[model samples]
Target chain A: MALKVYADRMSQPSRAVLIFCKVNGIDFEEILVDISKNQQFSPEYKAINPMHQVPAIVDGRFKLFESHAILIYICCAFPGVASHWYPSDLIKRAKIHSVLDWHHLNLRRGSAGIVANILMANIDGHRSYPQVVNQAEGILLKSLSKLENFWLKDGRFLVGGSQPSIADISLVCEIMELELLSEKDHDRILSPFKKVVQWIEDTKIATSPHFDEVHGILFKAQKRFRERMKTQSNLKAKL
Target chain B: MALKVYADRMSQPSRAVLIFCKVNGIDFEEILVDISKNQQFSPEYKAINPMHQVPAIVDGRFKLFESHAILIYICCAFPGVASHWYPSDLIKRAKIHSVLDWHHLNLRRGSAGIVANILMANIDGHRSYPQVVNQAEGILLKSLSKLENFWLKDGRFLVGGSQPSIADISLVCEIMELELLSEKDHDRILSPFKKVVQWIEDTKIATSPHFDEVHGILFKAQKRFRERMKTQSNLKAKL
Candidate 1:
C-alpha cells in the first residue's frame, strides 16, 4: 500500500508536504481534511492525528504529523530520494534542523499571524488592530532580514547550500500566503526585502510544477477574495 | 578543544541542552549568557547566534542554535553516546521529530507563556491580568491533557519507547518551569494531571544528577520569590 498523506492545500505546511511528495515522486494517497469545514475535528480524522493539524502521514502502521517531521520522514524513509534535500552530512542536516526549529516562533508565526489577522478583520467587518498588524509585520521583516543577511548570504538556499533543502520549501510556502492580501499591501510588506523576494522566486523555480500545483488552491482563494471585494465596493458606489 | 555551549539556566531550552550534554557525557564548556542582563543582545554574542537565543553551540567552526537542533547534533556528532537518545531507526527518529515539532506551539508555548506572565506581574508590581492567566492556563492544561492521553499513553518515554529520547528531555524541561511558580499555584496548575506528574518524575530519575543540577537555579529563584512574597505580606500587616 502507498503512503497516505492527509492535507489541505489551503494550509502552507500542507502545501509544503504535498509539493514535497509530488516533486520527489513519492507514491502516496492524498487525503484532504478540510479545515474550513472543520473536518479535521471529526472523530475519524482525530484517530490519525489527535492534534488535528494538517500535513500528517501514515506509512504502513506508523503515523506522523507536523509537516517538517513529515518532510524529514519522507526523505529518510525513502531510499531513492536525493541526499541534498536533507543531506546526510551532520553539519548540513544540523543547520537545516536549526532553521526548522527556529521557524515556528519566527517566520511561521509572523507570516501566519499577519495573514490570519488581516483575513479575520475583512470577514468580521472590523478594522484590523494596527498594533497587532504592526507587531506581526515587525517580526516578519526581522525574520526576513535574518534570512537575507545570514541564511542566504553565502548560497542560493537556506543553510548556505547549493540546492534548496526542505527548509527553503517550508519557509517559502509560508511567505507565499501574503499573496492573499491586496496587491499594494502584499508589495508593501515584501518590497523592503530584496533577497527574500529573489529567494522565493528561486525556491519556486527549483520546485517547479509541483509547487504551482500544490499552491493552486491558494491562488483560487485569492481570486475569490478579490472578486468579493470588488462587488462590495461596486455596491457601495451604487448606493 | 571542548565544544562550547552558550546558555542560561533560567531559560528552559538552555537548561535542556545543558542537562543533555552533561548527562550524555559529552565534553563541553558552558558559557553563561545571562538573558536577564540582556547579554544576548550584545554584538559579540549576536555574532555567535544571530537569533540571539540561548542553547547555541560552537562545534569547532560550525556554530548552531536552537536547543532541539543542538541536542540532535550532539547525539550525531559525538561517538560513544547511546543511540536510543536519537535512534537511527527511521520510524523511531521520525516519531521523535513529530513530538519535537508539535512541542513548539503547544507544550513549550503554553508553559513558557504562563510562567513569564506570572513572573512579569511580580517583577513589575502589577497584578497579573486574570483573563490572560486564565487563557494561558487553559492552553497549558489542554496541552497537558493531550500529553497524558495521547503521547504518554503507551510508553514510559515519549514515542512509546522504553528509553528517553531528546524529545523527552526537551519537553520535560519545558514543563519543569512550573517549579518557579508558588507552591500553591504550581500544585493548582499541575495537580490534575496525574500521568504527566509521573512522567516528570520518571524523566528526572532517568536523567538524575544532571537534571537536578541544571534546575538548581530555578529552585533558588523560586525560594527568592517566596521570600519576597512573605516579606511584602508581613509589611502590609504591620501597616
Candidate 2:
C-alpha cells in the first residue's frame, strides 16, 4: 500500500508537506482533513493522529505527525528525492535543522498567530481584537526582520544554498498565509523586507505548479473572505 | 582545536547540549556566556551567534545554534557515538524528530515560561504576578499531563525504546527547571505525574555525571533563591 498523507492545504505546514511530495514526485495518497470544518476532530481522524492535527502520515504501521518531522522522514525514507531538499552534507543538513528548529518559536509562530488573529477573525464573523492583533503583528515584523537581515542576508535561499531547501519551503509557505490579509495590510507588513520578498518569489518559482497547486485552496478561501467582508460592510452601510 | 560550545547551565537547551556532548564523549571546549549577567549580548558573542543565544557550537569555522540542531549535529558529526542516541531506523528517527518538534510549543515553552516568571521574580526581588503565574502553571500542567499520559505512556523512554534519545534529554532538561520553584510548589506540581518523575530518574541514570554536572549551576541557584526568600521573610517578621 502507498503511504498516506493526511493534510489540509489551508494549513501552512500542510502546504509545505504537499508541495514537497509533489515537487519530489513521491508516491502518496493525499487524505484531506478539512480543519476549518472541524473534520480533524473526528474519532476516525484521531486514530490516525492522537494529536488531531493535520499533516500526518501513515506508511504501513508507521505513523508520523509534525510537518518538519514528516518532511525529514520523506527525505530520508524515500529514494530518488533530490538531496538538495534536505542535503546530506553534515554542516548543510545541520544548518537546515537549525532553521527549522528556530522556526517553531519565531517565524511559524509569528506568521500563524498574525493570520489566525486577523484573517480567521474575519472568517469567524468577529472583529479582530486590536490588542491581540497588535501583538501578533509585532511578532510577525520582528521575525521578518530576522529573516531579511540574518537568514536571507547572504544567500538566495535560507540555508545559504544555491537551491531552496525544506527550510525555505516551510518558511515561505508560512509567509504566504499573509495573502489572506488585506492588500494594504500585507504590503505594509512585508514591503520593508526586500530580501524576504525576493526569496519568496524565488522559492515559489523553484517549486512552481506544486506550490501553486497546494496553495490553491488558500487563495480561493482568501477571495471568499474578501467578498464576505465587502458584503458585510455594505449591509452595515445600508443599515 | 576542539569544537567550542557557548553555553549557560541555567538555560535548558544549553544544559541539554552540554550533557549530550559529555555523555557521548564528544570533545568540546565549553565557553560560558552568562545570560543572567547579559553576557550573551557582548559584541564578541554576537559575532559568534547573531541570535545571541547559548547552546551554539563553533566546529572549526562552521557555527551553529538551536539546541535541537546542535544535538543532531553532535550525533551526526561525531564518530563512534551510539546510534540509538538518534538511531538509523527510519521510523525511530522520525519519532524522535516528532517529539522534538512537539516539544518547542509544548513542554519546553510551558516549563521554561513557568520557571522564568517564578525564578526571575525571586531573583529580581519582586513577587511574581499571580495572573501570569497562574496562566503559566496551567500551561505547564497541561504539558506535563500530555507527557505523562501520552509520550511516556508506552515505554521507559520517550520514543518507546530501551535507550533514551536526544528527545528524552531535551525534554527532561526543560522539566528540570521546575526544581527552582519552592519545595512545596515543586512537589505540588510534580507529585501527580508518577511516570514523568520516574522517567526523569531513568534519563538521569542513563546520562550520569554529565546530567548532574550540567545541572549543578541551576541547583546552586535554586538553593540561593530559597536562602534569599527565607531571609526576606525573616526581615518581614522583624518589621
Candidate 3:
C-alpha cells in the first residue's frame, strides 16, 4: 500500500505537495479531486478531509492535510532529503516556521486576487471589480518587492541563504497557480513581476532531478485546463 | 531584564500573547505599539518588525513575532511548560498546526472584515461605497458561521476534545475583536451568531487561566469606547 494523496493539480497546495514530493523523492499516490467539478464536496472526500479542501494525504493510518504541515511532515519523515528545506536546529526551524506563518498572512492572502478576479472572470462571464483586482495586484506586487527586499534578497530561494525551502515552494505555487489555473489575467497580471518569473524558472531547474513526473503533471494540468475552458459549463454538467 | 513584548492589546494577535503570558504565569514587560496611534510605523518599531505588525517579542538577543509561533516557542523555551499549552506528541502537535493553518485561511481571513468594515469605517467618512461595508458584513457573517460550524463542535476547545490549544486563544481574540472594535453594525450584524456567543463563554471557563486578562481587556476596550462615544468628534477620531 502507498501513501494516498487526495488532490487536484489545479490547487496551489496540491502543486506544492507535488513539487515537494518530486524534489524530495517521496512516493505517494495522487488522487485527483476536481474542484471545478465539485468532487471535493462529496461525502467520501469529506471523511478524509472534513474541510473538503485538497492536498490531503493518508499515510497508512495517519492522515494529514494543510500543505505546509504535510511539507514539514514529509521533510521530517524522510530524512536525508530536503534537510535544508526545513532545518533541524531549533532557531532555523523556527525561522522557517516564522516565514511559513508570515507567508500565509502575506503571500497567500495577496494572491487571492488572482483567483477571485481572473478565475471568476473566465468562469462566470462577469468583468471583475477593478478595485478588488487593483488591490490584489498591488498586494502581490508589494509582496514580490518585499520578497526581493527582505525575504528573498538575492538568496537563491526564500528563507535563509536560498537552496529552496518550503517557503519557495509555497510562494511559487501561488505565482504558478495563475498560470496553472489559467486565470483570465495570467499573462497580464504576472508579467510585471519579472523577479518572480525568473525565480520560478530558476526553481524549475533546481528541482529537475524528478522533472519527468513533476513537470509532466504540471503541464498536463495546463493542457487539461485549456481543453476544459472550451466548455466551462460542461465541468459542472460532468459532475 | 524582563522578556519584552512589543504589542497593542487591541490587536487580537497581541492580545493572544498577553493572555498566554498571563495564563502560563510568565511575567513579561508589555510594550505598547498602538495600532490606532500608527505606532507600528515609527522607525524604531519598523526596525523591530519590518512588516510593522503587532505582537512581537524580544528576550535578550532573540526576537520573535506571530502569536502562534511565539506561543509555541515560549512553550518549548520554558521547560515543563510546553506540554500544558501545546502538546508535544506528533499527532497532537500536528492537530495544532493543522487547526492553526485553517485559522489563518478562514478565521484570520474572515476576521479582516471586522477591521475593514467596523474599525476603518470612518476612514473615508462614509464616502466609500456602501457595497464595501455590505460585502465586508457579508464576509464577516459567512466567516462567523464557518468558525461556528467547522469548529466549536463536538469539542470544548478548538483543536480537540480536551483543553484549549493556542488555536482557541487566537480565535477568542478574533471573536472578541468584533465587539472591541465595535463595527457600527456590531449589534445588528454580530448578534445573530448564537453558537459563537456560547462557544466564547464555554472557552472562557475551559481556558480559565487567562479569562481575567481576556475579559479584562475586552472590558476595558469597550468601556473606553463607550466613554468616548459621548462626543461625536472623539468617536470619529478613535477606533
User: lDDT tens string, model 3, A1-239?
Assistant: 77788888767788788878867767778889999899999999887887789989887887788988888777766665757787766666666777788878677777866566855765657886778867877787677777767766646676656577777787777766566445545776666667667778777777776433545665776677666666775766788
Order of candidate numbers by DockQ, starting with the best: 1, 2, 3
Candidate 3 residue B208 Cα shift, in angstroms, is: 4.5
Specify the poorest-scoring 10-residue window by lDDT in model 1 chain B: B119-128
Off by more than 4 A, model 2: A120-128, A231-239, B120-131, B230-239
Query: How high is the TM-score of chain A in each model?
Result: 0.95, 0.95, 0.82
lDDT of 2 at B87: 90
Candidate lDDT (C-alpha), each: 0.90, 0.90, 0.73
Q: Which candidate ranks first by DockQ, i.e. highest?
A: 1
lDDT of 1 at B171: 97
Instruction: Report the lDDT of model 2 for residue B46.
Output: 92
TM-scores vs. true structure, each candidate: 0.96, 0.94, 0.83
Note the clash tally of each candidate: 0, 0, 0
Model 3 chain B poorest 10 in a row by lDDT: B118-127
Mind giving the per-residue lDDT tens digits that candidate 2 earns over B151-226?
A: 8988999989788999999999999999888888899999999999999999999999889989999889889988
The count of residue-pair clashes in candidate 1 stands at 0
| lDDT by residue (tens digit), candidate 2, A1-239 | 98899999999999999999999998899999998799999999988887778899999999899999999999998997898999999989999999999999988778888888887676677777888788878888988998998999779998886899999999999999999987778899999999999999999999998999889988898889878877877888999
Give the poorly placed runs of model 1, Cα more than 4 Å off.
A230-239, B232-239
Which 10-residue window of candidate 2 chain B scores lowest in summed lDDT?
Answer: B119-128
Q: Write the per-residue lDDT of candidate 1 for residues A168-215, one digit (tens) a residue.
A: 999999999998887778999888888899999999998998899889
Ranking by TM-score: 1, 2, 3
